[model samples]
Target: MDQSCDRTRNSLSQSPTPPLVGVETGPASEFTGKYMVLLRDGEMKEGLQAIKRVASLTSVCVAADYEGAAVRMDEAGKAEVFVLDKLGVAVVSADPPQLRRLQSAAAEGGAILAVEPERIMYAIEPARDRLAILDYLRGYRDAVNRLYDSLTGVPGEAEKELAALTAFTDNAEFTWGVQATRVNQSRFSGRGVRVAVLDTGFDLDHPDFVGRPVVSHSFVHVQTIEDVHDHGTHCIGTALGAQQLAGGVRRYGCAFGGDIYVGKVLSNQGSGADSAILAGINWAITNSCRVISMSLGARVQPGGAFSSIYENVAQRALTSNPGALIIAAAGNDSNRPIVIAPVSRPANCPSILAVAALDSNLGIARFSNGGINPNGGGVDVAGQGVSVFSSVPDSFPAWDQPGGPGRPWPPRYHTISGTSMATPHVAGIAAMWLEARGAGTTAQGLWQLLTGSAVRLLLPSRDVGAGLVQGPV
Candidate 1:
């Protein structure tokens, strides 16, 4: 065989299909090159005797009481096919999370074999070799493998920045039944809510956020999927950052933790036009994101009315099934030549919620958008925006750099001010609201309920809309 062919064959030799390990398309045996049975019966001797009767093999390694070895082997790039005892109580009633971890580890390596509960005897008893090869090839690079995964990015590769969560004990002053967590703690801890914030980007490596699994994508011509503008992650930290990180604490950030999706719609300059936001909105909807928070906006809408991409997409995005709630920043530019786009454009559209900024003291942010909406319903609600602390990417202008001209690595975190900061708090609260309404609530309902439930701050109803948000009541 040629060099390339030889390399391809070698990659497959490492799989763990056990003849019928993956998605069941056909009979198991026409697959597995070899297989083993992890007996479920109580009598170890009887299980071994069964294995002996079933095979011509001489040696055997006992399956861990918890499948730890199988999991570890797969993680370490060894052990192809495995027969998990279907009869053992512990094995049958295995912990779902541990099992999922094992599965994940296997997928990472491209080799893993798991027998159906007590049915190892059934799935593999007939044929094992083909299954083994399948498991091996799943992790290995072979001609048969073809998928949407990025072929350019190496598997298990590391990113430019590693997020670290610094935990702190809450000083009584920092406590106040925060909008998102208070509700989440009382009710929905975002159990399974998949919140995709299409703003900046997330600190994919942060400890509090590690569990949710961040899927990042960049839309602007200048940025890549690893976009770390810090806008998106800060928004994310407010919505789903884990509280009380084990053995430590983070003063502010993270809404008690849940799944977070990062759809970067803005450019590194932190400015995004309609097209990018539209692409991000469409992608989030296509990905079935329940709540999408957009804290970034542009100043010039010189294009015709529908020409404003953010508004157009917001209107069209509302038309999808189950739909998605699009939350936007009401701009920090105070009333002026064109203070900010009226809610009607983006927030004013069908299902959008245009949010203004509020300070921790619960008042309109001094620099927030205002004046009056010549045509309209109330403006929108407010959330904690002033003096907020959040993640800053290595490239954010807020940070000072060293080595690479202006760009730096291993960034130092900083806090900045903007309605951009306040918008996320509202977005996070909206997500918690979605969780409270249960599975029946759609993205549209989330926006309406949020608008309706707002506490109506002192500002003119048009300035603050329904008012300030209160924890889910």
Candidate 2:
């Protein structure tokens, strides 16, 4: 949803096909030949030892070779061979026969609970032509600025005129989604709630969020927590930006008082593997975040089942303290006028809440993916996505002129359209509901509250699910 399509497009085209359930394959199968073994809670040390023993017998180097291995501390704060102890999962490279032997040993020793093949996942592409629209807006703003500057010879007059124009744009009414969902009328501000947004990353220096408490972590090894790609910043802003900008104008944020947790699952190029996303989820769960919002995913073919590993992880997170509810974008692969795409991976997982995109007119966005899969694998709700206005990094590169100084006119907000944009609206609304429900609320209860409270719109169940998500009264 970052408007950068090169990497994502290639990923989509070359993505590996998922294996069928209970299907037997040879060592030369297209599968990655790598398996993620999930250890039982409180059995990480035993699991590691068992894995090391298997490696020794098989003559394969342990993934956790202390000298030059991929070393990272575990959740227990101990420097371990694998980096996913908190999630109780370990990545091991092995062929079918080797994996079976490892599984047998793990089961016999009570080291691992389950084993699953590591699958490839790509970031969902956003609505097309968004960058062009942004550029047009920037040009219009520059024109307005030049005209204002040329007309006003006196400093005081120029200042007064600029203030008036800023006020006009700032004092605009609530966004259509906010008004349609009646979030503007909600008294609850999601105070004392921690919401984790797993995406590209965030703009550490964005002025609009300057003093807001944000706990951040980077799961993508190549990238830091700094959001060079604007997708994560835009999603985070909609979820937890300040009610008022630095200039005391524009009331855009929904959960103004909610605690923010930024997890960089995707790399700076707006692409990442499933391992990084799984790690981000583990981190969010470890932090006890009440709601985890994911605005990225990979497209799924019709009849494709959800990822069992993600579903299991989400179920575990739901049973954690205060419970963590995952809300994800349904994807932007649909063409309402022609073909309708099914819900994507991660979101297609039944335990996760899949959100679709709605326009200002209460119509389903043409690019919003549909709920083609039956049972629990469709969209659960809708949110505002088209022409959505939210915060972006002050120094975002896309906003800069081709040959001009690095800085284009400084901007605190941007407009984008995608199910990715729609996801945070639901996330923020969920936070408000949590705040109103007070303590001792579970993830399933929050999901019910959200769907039951949604306003029924005149759209297909496949397109809009339970309808548009609403805020607490």
User: Which candidate has the top score in TM-score?
Assistant: 2
lDDT by residue for model 2 (357-401), tens: 876556677678888877456888998877676777765543444
Q: Which has the greatest lDDT? A: 2
Q: List model 1 lDDT by residue over 54-84, tens digit each.
A: 3323343333332222122222112222222
Candidate 2 minimal-lDDT segment of 10 residues: 15-24
RMSD of each candidate relative to the true structure: 24.5, 12.2
RMSD of 2: 12.2
lDDT of each: 0.46, 0.69
Clashing pairs in 2: none
